[model samples]
Target: MDFTSLSLAYPWEQLPYALFAIILAFTIHEFAHAYVAYKFGDPTAYQQGRVTLNPVAHLDLFGFILIILAGIGWAKPVPVNRYYFKNPRLAGVLVSLAGPLSNLLLAFLCFPLLLLADQFGLGYKGIIELLFMIIKINIVLFIFNLIPLPPLDGYRIIEDLVSNRTRAKMSQYEQYGIFIFLLIFLIPPLNKLLLGPLFQYLVPAIYRALDTFWSLFL
Candidate 1:
């Protein structure tokens, strides 16, 4: 999920592809959240137009810039009212998971196009690059959103799973969640310790599985 390489190694010409990928990935991620929340009886996001696929509805200015510059950022979070759900805990977890899962779905959908581009040596190199960029950004979004920390889908899932008392304790420290998240990425040792294995192993494994599955068809 580390995009440091994209920023440093890729030329300025590729920025448009990266930006397109980011908009699509982030839009789908947030839309999944809003749609799921709406399905589970929360109209909050829907009423606010957060359920739309339009990137403008989901993109946050600062977050979008950070994603382009640093490769780590977020979209406008879909608003949800858990009180509207009959089973708040379960619904909450599902709603929280929707965003990351949507990104994974996007990555899965893009894999075959990427494979075809490679297999046929597509003359339009830009198209191939765009597909690759889309896949990479979506996969990164999937993995990064699932890290169990505040302001992330994983943390929301955890918050739903825990008891009320534990959740209350978590709430007390919610203000520091963003700081902690930044520390994990900003501190090299911490980033290596927490996300190294995930990016190194899990991401590759996912691609391998996708390749194996798609190879049968292509």
Candidate 2:
């Protein structure tokens, strides 16, 4: 509750800010999908009254807890009925990609904030810490969601790209999806294997970009 009061180290310090980033990212991510789906004529989310930005309506208790413990978890998915779409396959792709793409946009937005802070000589540790979290969370959400795993947005996008036969076969894995997902996430080798690029490259690039952008603007 006391965000600034929280103390965390160089690596772990990003946790609190990550918490806020995830909440904001997922809220907007899901909201955008819902809004677009509604605009495109799917009323399921609207009918369920999920068009609001109040994250309480979207947060998943288990997922929220996982963020504190495991560091990655998801809010409740915004309900979408693809049958309501005029072009189900294409619509599904956009809807699925929307979540992670929103996070990327968030990361981009953070750059300007960092620059603004720097301009005022306000690149305090707290602000840097917050920007770090923003970068990490956005990248994690982008790469993690882009994984072609079941029920994740990335998988839907993949499904749109693959053959119909594969899609049909893959549907069977849906029921067991989350367990498989967590198993992979918790498996150290597999987890690192997945995040190697994210930590080694993507994150550093983001930090450098923000720093450079700030230098230019400030």
lDDT of 1 by residue, 158-198 (tens): 99999999999999999899799999987779888988998
Worst lDDT run of 10 residues, candidate 2, spans: 5-14
- Candidate 2 C-alpha lDDT tens digits along 25-84: 778778877887888789999988778799887788888867766666778888989889
Off by over 4 Å in 1: 1-10
Best model per lDDT: 1
Error of 1 at 71 (Å): 1.8
TM-score of each: 0.90, 0.83
User: What TM-score should be assigned to candidate 1?
Assistant: 0.90
RMSD of each: 3.8, 3.9
